[model samples]
Target: MSLTLEQRLDTLPAGAEVAWCGQQYVTAGQLRADVATLAGWLAAHPARHWALCLDDAYAFTVALLACGMAGCVAVLPGHRRPAGLEEQAPYIEALLVDGDWSSAVLSFPVCHWQAVMAAPLSAAPTTPWPAPLSVLMFTSGSTGVPQAILKQERELLAEVEIQAGLWADALAGAVILATVSQQHIYGLLFRILLPLRLGLPLAAATCTTPEQLQAAVRGLMRPWALISSPAFLEHLDPDLSCPGARWLVSSGGPLSASGAALSQRCLGLSPVELYGSSETGGIAWRQQHGSDWMLLPGLTLSVDAAETWWLTSPFLPAGQRWALSDRLVWQENGFRLLGRADRVIKLAEKRISLDEVERRLRAVPWIAEAAVVPLEIGGRRCLGAVLIPSAEGWRLHATLGEGRLLLQLRQALRPWLEPVALPRRLRCLSAMPVNSQGKRPYAVLKELFDVAIEC
Candidate 1:
């Protein structure tokens, strides 16, 4: 059997220093011992399945490793609220909630993570004995309620191989520092899983602030790459100026050419983009300088009747042709992403296509980030914008839509955007919110606007 992730951990330098913040150093031996101590405690709660809410990278990584070995799935319900998601948590015996969102639900035998280490030291379960599904990510269910996607142990391994093989040269012996969360797939693969799977050193510092990102990079040595989301990348032109960073890999949303060009200008490197979904791991990818994806090696592709590309790969079960939600423009041996099939919306007898709006938004000067979401106001359709301005747009939010800027907006969009597709509600913030995977959680955005915006 292939060396399991834990067994493979032995291949790294046995006592190599792991610096999470330059303050905490745990050698490989110490890490193993810590997990043993922690897992020792977890054994006491055998009757309760864990509903985990771990946010930090190092803690999340090590804890997950321990949880997997302990056979207690550290279930991630994928919702911010506890009880709402917990009420439906499958096989949930109890909760392991974070203090900020923690509810009294823990009163019935809930164990804080600290209690886990004191339970019992069950020797690491024989490595890789068909590891159980450790992750449970929720999604928009078919009937419009949240649903969970069960991720198997081997699937995470397969993802590591696909990315490491495809981007092998960039990743060989390189360390990863990320602003994304460990609970989500994009961050899990690029930030936490890949490095651990390869036995490489990882920066424990989960850089959440722009300053933190710069600080994390400055503290690291060479061959370090930033695993970030489009929102994070779009916000930081100054932080990208750090000469220490070797490369950046951005996903979770589309990165516009302007943003990529800005990054290349500030940092010597351009952010490489990944294309994939929660369903089928990373399928194809392109660099800021490339035009189309160099599809993942060995994936089979055929066109559907509608001309969208249908794909199959060894990562998936045999003969399963995966139909993607995103449209594709297939070439003789390549393809380009056309928009997502579900992103289009209708407006006053006119269809406001996402591709059309995206192209127009990109043409606007200094419009660093834009999400043209269509929402209904009193049953009448309208558009909303959450814009991240370029440096020049720093002072304009309070003055927008009142006088000169409003005129400028109309002039900029007049020829292209149909009136109905024009943003009826314009909200500007210093930065936008991104979820675990780097995708903008639209529902969360609505919350940000709840107090300040009125349609």
Candidate 2:
């Protein structure tokens, strides 16, 4: 019987199970039942848009799918804070939170996953319609406040073609152990949608640690595709070297050249890098160690006068020359990426803005002027800030010093840069790292940062 998504999921094979990080497993039947139960709770509130703020992947799946089934749109905001909630409240009518429910943050019904799963699957709504503009994935606010990227069912089809076909070399019987999160588009494609749509095996849990990865590999039947980022690859335990897989996939930031070489030597699979973002979804992809890509067979990219990326994609919504922030160098064969047009620095596998870092430092009150520059140390890039305070420079600088200052700054930077890129060296200076328009010149900052560290 040729069936739709709901029908296919409602009757998946009994034996096929999602290995939950090698700790446990959940069958297709259980997943369907969980979604079905939540579908009932969702039916209670109509025309309500809900958000999933919890860290758990499986709970997010159930909540999202249940909302899709009930014809209610779901807004996936990046940062779930009072500010984030305030900005996105206009799009959604309510919020959906898991276990440690925050009554202070939410004004809507806060039901546990257990409560949701126990609830009956009210009246089955009309089968999947034109997506109902259900999901609103926020653009990475690296440039500014996140913008909502509305997605329909067609996104599932788009992801399958771009990501699932290229990186995921999983055969008919093979499974995929996703290291990325499904809440984000990239993760949603590899972890949840592709597995559900194309019938590839997926790990139930989001594996982070190497021990967890080893356990996941031992448990799964096949060498799974590890969906991951450069950050995870760099810090991976050098001792634990058993990641047997068909291949691996990485995105979000550039995979370090050294790390890629190490991964191939250790894990036996060089990651396939994807060049795209939350705004335009995935555009082009290539093998980590290999050169160039097949391109997205049908698409072509061009540059405008100010030198911006203009894309023409068949998979994209009815559009042509969709302008995006990422700039590119169009080579004869494939393409080479520059970086984000914004002032953000894609360093140490994290996306952070130099300006944003400066802004945070000035808010300390004592610091009269502050500027941040991206500097490289030990073949890895790190943040370097030059501060001019009201008090004597040496007094303030000596108090924190370079070593102790790094430890102090890291605490403040947890909200900005990922662990790896926090500054190792601090310098006291009279000025910040910016031009007249308050613009940061990439070349100038890189040179000063390098010189200061060497000094």
In TM-score terms, which candidate is top? 2
- lDDT values, one for every candidate: 0.64, 0.65
Backbone Cα, N, C clashes tallied per candidate: 7, 0
Number of the predicted model whose lDDT against the real structure is largest: 2
Give one digit per residue, the lDDT tens place, for model 2 in 260-331: 886686678777788776656678888744465446756777777888768887556776457766666667
Which ten-residue region of model 2 has the weakest summed lDDT?
124-133
Error of 1 at 318 (Å): 5.2
User: For each candidate, C-alpha RMSD in Å?
Assistant: 12.2, 4.3
TM-score of each model, paired residue for residue: 0.70, 0.80
- As for candidate 2, its clashing pairs are none
